[model samples]
Target: MGRVKHNMVKSLGKRTSSSVSPTDGSKKRSTLQMDLEVLECPICFETLTKPIFQCDDGHLACSSCCPKLSNKCPTCAFPIGHIRCRAMESVLGSISIPCPNAKFGCTDNVSYGLESTHVKECIFSRCSCPALDCDYTGSYRNVCKHYYSYISSRSTPLHHYAFLLYKASSTVRMNISDKIKIHVDYTNELLFVVQCFRESYSVCVTVSCIAPSSAKVGKFSYQLSYTVDGDTMTYESPDMKRILKVSFQTPLEKFMLIPHSSLRGDLLETKLTIKKVIQV
Candidate 1:
């Protein structure tokens, strides 16, 4: 079924002379102004693709939905899933539109039927500000302007791609929240948050990234270590979980557990290292 869909889109590409790139010297496809809701699969509310199925009464469903509905039409008790709606498939295959994030500087044109998938990984996807008091939401590219302004005075600067031995200062220890904010350089502006929680016999430390969970922008790895009485304890993470907004809820997993006895004067000290991984 997947191969059929791919081939249908491929064949439609040959039928049109649209240039995805204007500089490629190919003619652009003619624009159409049709109601897109007509192309959605009513059952799933997703854009309809090839293999659209219809009932005798004209009720339509996508291929995946036809089987789930037990080969019966939802609107009418009539049988479905056998007949192919080739006219609808051709309409879906020929339609393409600029990404929804095009307003945020995305230039790629994607098939109208696949726009939902493209939006999930769009680099220009908007992210909510992680600062508790701020309700700002903007594209990752333009958000740093609002981000750095608030955190510059209170956040610690992090040196990327290297290990930095950091000691928790007295001021941080005295803070009621026991949270530390690290701001990476502007070029790769990612906010790292380290939060400490006091348990009955241990101190739990967690690190997280503040970014949109769906944005496919940056990949990072981090290492945290603490040394007590000549013995060292370490925690390394290949990737940090991203959050859309700041929350006070305690992490349920993937936290570094440190014994309260390992503390010197009740201070939490650790060596922190972070490296950004480039994806091909």
Candidate 2:
């Protein structure tokens, strides 16, 4: 699921070969990367997996792509079915591959058979915090530890405000986020950011909202409701108001700690919906 969110595909293509002559008529061998591409599944373009299936004539397809194929091999009209390519599986086992989330801060070198299991539990897998007033994102387990704190239970009547984060890592404030105040010279020209706070005795979730770019932002206020640590709370931002040409990136502001063991299933599986509440 996490892999799908980023749209970073890991497809491989069928072995490709062509006879060509360069201007200099030099013959060069294909690189290792090119060799790897030869193993890609022709159906999905993703890299092949173990237990690769093949036709009697030896044309190959991954376990995932094999089931989707017709009875006949796409490459050759040979009879194709659930024939495991043990040789290919052995080849896969001998290779070491990096976890897909390596770009996201995960640094694990897993054997072919264990790659799936490692990625499933990669700590750096993204589960961003999207609260109403701040913007922040962290690993799946960690993003659930942040939230917002508003000046008023409802919207602040005024527009000028500063952003702040309070630490509840323990009874004492483990760390306090830096106060963010825009550096505008004039008096309160109605420019400020709000930070709202909510906590639960169980299932704690942290939130930080990232405001869209001025041009991309719509006229919309926001609301967030979550039950955490056996506590339920809802937070509402000010009503939608359009801004003019001036713009700034939304600042980040709060967090509440939640342990992963307490959650029921994959943290990546948890989905939060953002509704655009409208008033006539």
Candidate 3:
């Protein structure tokens, strides 16, 4: 009976020791698990991707953290301006971030420092062409095509012989001929150049208002002729505001017209009116 009682006591002791060992091991494992799971930015409360340190006060934050504490800690009111830790930064930089737009069909996980650059070049990014009366917006390639289509639809058709005129100053008769070349002056207030007739006869034109605050008023005259391979060809003017004068020398047609320019308080305005004279 005594031997049985002693063995029972020893068995109970062994059981207790065995139970205590597992409990201690479980506690240690639980602590390690908590430490592994606690990796997150304190400021953002998200996974610690691109982590940055606030100070020695144990404020771990993300790199994109905003200045919310006026350069001081909100919790302890500690100055954080001079506080920096490169080791913490490197640790944060090693973290991975799930795409913010992941729900929008992005499945990329990138470093926090590379998030902005990735978003900039993302194929899913949409942009719209900035044009009046255009409603097109899409991917970069689509936007390019949309812009081209809009521009092509609104572009003015070029004519074989065309003349554009603007007013410069009063009593100054400036003529832009299809047979003359025009040059622009950058230093002058109004500088432009016109070229015609294969750059044979070019003209440099400039006009400045006599008064800085007031607009300069003037008129313009234009003459246009069409030719092909040194042979005269028939041509026509498409505007009617000017008196169209047409003359024919064999197969060649020459047209001349006078136009006007107006100014209102430093604004110069000119309009071109085209009229048809000949087709062949």
Q: Whose lDDT is greatest here?
A: 1
lDDT of 1 by residue, 162-201 (tens): 2123222111122224454444345656666677777788
lDDT of each: 0.66, 0.42, 0.36
Give the winner by TM-score: 2 or 3. Answer: 2
Error of 1 at 95 (Å): 1.8
Put the candidates in lDDT order, highest first.
Answer: 1, 2, 3
- Candidate 1: segments with Cα more than 4 A from true spot: 1-29, 49-51, 56-58, 63-68, 81-87, 152-183, 194-218, 224-272, 278-280
Q: Regarding lDDT, does 1 or 2 come out ahead?
A: 1
Instruction: Provide the TM-score for each candidate, comma-separated.
Output: 0.56, 0.39, 0.32
Which window of ten consecutive residues has the lowest lDDT sum in model 1?
Answer: 167-176
Q: Rank the candidates by TM-score, best first.
A: 1, 2, 3
Highest TM-score model number? 1
- Model 2 TM-score (2 dp): 0.39
lDDT of 2 by residue, 132-226 (tens): 35455554224333322222344543233332221111111111122221211122112212222222432333332233223222223434444
lDDT of 2: 0.42
User: Scored by Cα lDDT, where does model 3 land?
Assistant: 0.36
